[model samples]
Target: MIDFCNVSKVFNTDLLKKDFHALKSVTFNIPEGKTIGFLGANGAGKTTSLKIAMDFIRPTSGEIKYNESLGKNKLEAFKNIGYLPERPFFYPHLTGLEFCHYMGALTDLSKAEIESQVNVWAIKFKIDFALNRHIKNYSKGMLQRIGFLATLLHNPKLIILDEPLAGLDPIGRKELKDIIVQLRDEGKTVFFSSHIISDVEEICDSVIFLKDGEVVFNGSVDQIMKDNIKPETRISYFDGDSLLTEVIPNNKKEEYLSKLLKDGKEIVSLQAEKPTLEEIFYNVKKN
Candidate 1:
């Protein structure tokens, strides 16, 4: 678990460049065993916040507090946290299996342990056959899968992934999502940043939206949709040879439906318009 309290970060080390504030008093809490999505567009401080949380960069102000158990030593703390950057760097010459073993060693795992875990994850990810091939020969999706395998090699309690689903085909995205869900089922906390709202909607229990270096929204997806999206119900009916449709406020659906039936209209279909996360995200951004 992690907490960001009024965190702010500014980049101005270069005298020739203007100061850029990547984060401005962004505050959020990541509870354990939950999938939390950091939703934001490009340059919205998602990566900046993650970097600050991992202590890769120092914040201009505020504090990031980790669980007491993971706060004592930096190296020890990282042992329970797995991180996959937006663009992962792999040893191009190394085979997938060798890379996994190398990453496992960095995490202080024994050879036998790494081999066992690699076998299990390779099969789960359906990349067992590609493990012997050099990483340079793998496709983008294959590389992404290998990155995920490396991240999970240590069995970290919290997994931090930046744009994990980006650049993958639909099937590849589905596979990665399934793996994330499995992590949740196994009680591992997942904190990932993504611009793709649909992916977050599918997996995240809670979401934090950022815009222009500010925290615009932080709450459950359902609550956000209910608060930001207008309620509407649509009805379609057939009148003789003509088709008619009516859209009404959700609160007045029952009253309007009765009126339609009383008017001898043959109702063909009735449906409530549920707002998608994409709609909700855009609505929030516009405001």
Candidate 2:
């Protein structure tokens, strides 16, 4: 668990350009054992925020607070964190298994522990068969899979992933999403940044939506949807050989449905019009 309070970051560019404000007093919380999605478009400060959270870069102002459960100090607490950057560096010559071992060693995991973990997760990640092949020979999806294996090698309490689903095919994305759900099931805290709104909506309990370096929304997915719900009902009906669809305001829905029923039209389906996360994101951005 972590609390990012009013964090801001500014980058100074050369000569003619003005200082860039990558983050503008952003604030959000990563609750313990929750899958928190960082949702934003490109150049929207998602990566900057993650980097600041990881302490890879210092914020220009404000502070990030870690729960004592993380550790007594920063160094000790960081040991319990597993991070996968958007573009992770890999040794081209090293085989997948070798690469995982190298990463595990950095976390001070024993060789036996590393081996056992690799054996278990490799099978789950569907990369077991290719573990002995050089990473250079692996495809992009394969590389992402290996990177994930390495990240989980230590079983960190908090997993921080930047664009973890980037560049993967649909099947690969689904596989990785399944792995993330598995991690959440195991009660691990996952804070991942992604531009993919639908994927975030699928697996995340809560989300932090950013726009142009500002915090637009931060809370439960259900709450946001509820807040922006459309006050309309959509109905489908069959009349003789034809099917008709209608959108009615909530106040008039019952009256409209009664008339359709009185007309002897067969009602096929009726439901409230709900906005998707994508729609909500765009609406928020536009406003």
Candidate 3:
């Protein structure tokens, strides 16, 4: 729902030190109703890009164009965006329900509307049982869950999550990922940043990879995986009550499979090896 066109950001420091280039002519599109993963390692400008998109930090050069669907003006558009920062601060003394109410009030939501949204989302997020408990008593995952519930209280069309999965346990990660997918199914545009490639690969329909303040790759996840498929195939077969596994070159796979079949070996399984997103990410960094 947003187009980042040739965006660049520079942080000027002391005269003795050089300016830091946080982003270098980065360009990408967050299409409507799609779950887009902003992938990058630490200090790779992922956060900078999101900040620019949110208008939290101005880009030194270039601009971000919001689709008219967001609103006619910037203020109206921003109202339609739900954002959760990487290190969100919450009132330690406020209970979860109270926190949600406070956030909803900022969004101009009425008390009744806030209460209704919280009732639905808190249950779905699995944090409803603890809504009356103090925030300081919540675990890391619980904090993240409450943060998300608060973000969605307004039902924004576009949800921008900065490192949403960071510091989450495996179960926490899975729960958040499932929520992201649910948002997609409900036709919400989600652009989330993360250094975790496996989590992104599992849930993102498409991904934008940033390396050193540059856009390295931006396209469909399936297409990228297909393009980076390994040039070998793995096979498993039962031979004399023993299972044998082998990896063969793509060119020799057919020949090898034929030989095994001709020899009466029971073929157990055949799989074409493919590079994981992590592998591809390392390769991108090396390049």
| Model 2 C-alpha lDDT per residue in residues 61-159, reported as the tens digit of each score | 999998898988788888899999896658999999999989999989999999999999999999999999999999988888899999999999999
**Model 1 weakest 10-residue run by lDDT:** 68-77
Which residue pairs does candidate 3 place in steric collision?
Answer: 1-30
Greater lDDT among 1 and 2 belongs to 2
Model 3 residue 184 CA deviation in Å: 0.9
Assess the local accuracy of residue 163 in candidate 2 as a C-alpha lDDT between 0 and 100.
99
Candidate 1 vs candidate 2: the TM-score winner is 2
lDDT (0 to 1) per candidate: 0.91, 0.93, 0.93
- Candidate 2 — which pairs collide? none
Candidate 1 regions off by >4 Å? 69-71, 236-246, 259-271
List the candidate 3 regions with Cα displacement exceeding 4 Å. Answer: 240-242
* Rank by TM-score (best first): 3, 2, 1
Quote the RMSD, in angstroms, for model 3.
1.4
| Candidate 2 segments whose C-alpha is farther than 4 A from its true place | 240-244
